[model samples]
Target: MQHAIAILDSGVGGLTVVKEIMRQLPQEKIIYFGDTARSPYGPRPADEVRLFTRQIVDYLAQFAPKMIVIACNTATAVALDDIRRHVGIPVVGVIHPGARAAIKSTRSGMIGVIGTEGTIRSGAYEQALKRISPGLQVFSLACPRLAPFVERGLFGADEAEDVVRSSLEPIMNVPMDCLILGCTHYPFLADAIGQVMGPGVKLISSADETAREVSAILYHKGLLSESADIPLHQFFCSGDPALFKQIAQTWLSEQISITPVIWQVPNIV
Candidate 1:
């Protein structure tokens, strides 16, 4: 039987990874769990983050995914190790994949990563990059408001555009060959980010690299979906159904009929 992958994130940000997975590996089925109710995990405490992440992973495991992707940067920073220890399945996080990709893309040997405060403070990306290539220089900043902007469907609005530009100003003057979209909601502001950073600096989406990693791991484990036929994908949100579906359709640029799935927190635990 073909194995499905479970993708858990604090919110819609993980869709960036999911979208890439669908495009790159058409036959693989995916179960996406978005903890919209407790999103913007960037500011939460480590223990709280870990508990929340574990709940999502445990909930998704009900589907018996061959592996799970902790797609939120904050969750990956705080809870990845816990998830790996608790779950025997291959659990992958976005940090290493993104850091590796940045290393490969940087010409100036300098890279900038922006995510929620939790992600930046954890220093996971910085540590991961050094592990991959000790010589690479990494600069990271936190953007707590970015996720909220995207979540509220304000990504392209004038205020959001201004926010993107202003937030990027600090890193713009730095000499870097590439920037990592460390947070998943970030791809939604790609145009604005690219504009501020200029075309000279390539923006690397962790989602894209993470998806590629998913392809390799599944292939190596002999767990890649066997059926040549296209697989069904499901999306569940722990928040407003109409809003989730609306934002999903806009961000994905594809129609998504997402039915609301009321996820009980304590039940998963």
Candidate 2:
């Protein structure tokens, strides 16, 4: 059987990645999982994030995906290697692609990174950037409340603008010419962030870069879809399936079916 690319995030944020995938790899099948019940993995402990990511990976694995993509910045920062080592399938994450894109976009050698608390605190983007360009100056800020706002589907609201402006005010003073939206969820707020940062700064969305990486990987593995028919796309959420479905349809501009992945509470018989 031809397998699909499995993508997961802490919540609907992963759809950003999925959107790019559908656009870039229109022929490829996709299976996406959103851990919405435990959304906003940013503030959670690294171990907790890792545990949750592993559980989601295990669930996605049953589908026999050709590859797995951890579309969440916090999960990629905290749990990527662990999942890679544990899973039989090839695993991809957002940090390297976002870092590479930022490195390529910046002319001033100074770049800014905005992500969840876990991702920023992990220094994943900074480490990835410096690894590519040793002398580059990297500034990272953790926008803890930003993901929650997006997850709640508050992207265009005045409250979102206020939160985005306040969250980005510190980085606006920096002289960075390129900013990486390190969190997958952040792209939903890109307009508000772009307005606050103005046109001088180039904002790099991890979704776009990641989709490119996925294409490259699939090509190298000789796994690119060969079917002439439109590929199948599936979405699963661990929380509020109705809300997730509603937001996804609006965001992706398509009607979609969403299956809820209920986390069963273990019995203590």
Candidate 3:
């Protein structure tokens, strides 16, 4: 059996990263786990998020994947280094890739970052951005409501625009040239977010950059799949399978056409 790439998130938010992976590296197999029962890791305590991340990583270990991608920004901010210490395989997180993308896209040094409370509180993006370019002006906001909204599969509703507008009101007038959808889940609401942020601010999603990083790491390590045949992807969620399936199918269909195999794991909680 070919070694699969393991990706885990707090909920459907990580599907954004999965879509990018499927597009950029079609031959690679994916094993994804969504802790939908505990959908928003954003507001949780850092220690708790780290514990949940460790549990999920331990669960995915049975598959013996070649790499593990911590696709949730909240989890990435808190648990990334801990997971790396616990696992033997390569570990990737969405934070640095996102910071890198925002740096490249910004014409003005002012960049805005919106994420869950935990991500913004951790100061991870700000640190990552400053480490790359010392003089960057970074604005960070915690949009605590957005992730839960997307997790419920309501990102397409008319009310989504209103919610996005209200959530982003604080940063709307900032003269930033680009905004990082700091949470992976934010991409699900990209349409509403883009409309609110206007044309001048580029919306940078770590999904694309993270996918590129995954491909680069695999290539350098000689772990890229050599098979030409399409791979079957496995998805597992801890909450409502029907809802998770509905959102997954809707979002993934827009990117890559696939009939995903989804399972509900009740023991993770």
What is residue 131's positional error in candidate 3, in angstroms? Answer: 1.3
* Model 1, runs deviating above 4 Å: 255-269
lDDT (tens digit, per residue) of candidate 2 on 51-106? 99988888777789999999999999989999989988779999999998888888
Q: Which pairs of residues clash in candidate 3, taking residues 3 or more apart in a chain or in different chains?
A: none
- TM-scores, each model vs. reference: 0.94, 0.94, 0.97
Q: Rank the candidates by lDDT, best first.
A: 3, 2, 1
Error of 2 at 45 (Å): 0.4
Taken over the whole model, the C-alpha lDDT of each candidate is 0.85, 0.88, 0.93
Off by over 4 Å in 2: 254-269
Model 1: colliding residue pairs: none
What tens digits encode model 3's per-residue C-alpha lDDT throughout 91-134? 99999999998888888899999999999999999999999999
Give the local distance difference test score of model 3. 0.93
Model 1 C-alpha lDDT per residue in residues 1-269, reported as the tens digit of each score: 56688998888889889888878887788888888888778899999999999888877877889999999989999999999999999998998898989888888899999989999999999999988788888888888878888888788788877899888878889888899998988998898899889989999999999999999998898888879866767788777667777777776665243333434444542
* Root mean square deviation (Cα) for candidate 2: 2.6
What's the CA error at residue 209 for candidate 3, in Å? 1.6
Cα deviation at 115, candidate 1, in Å, is 1.1
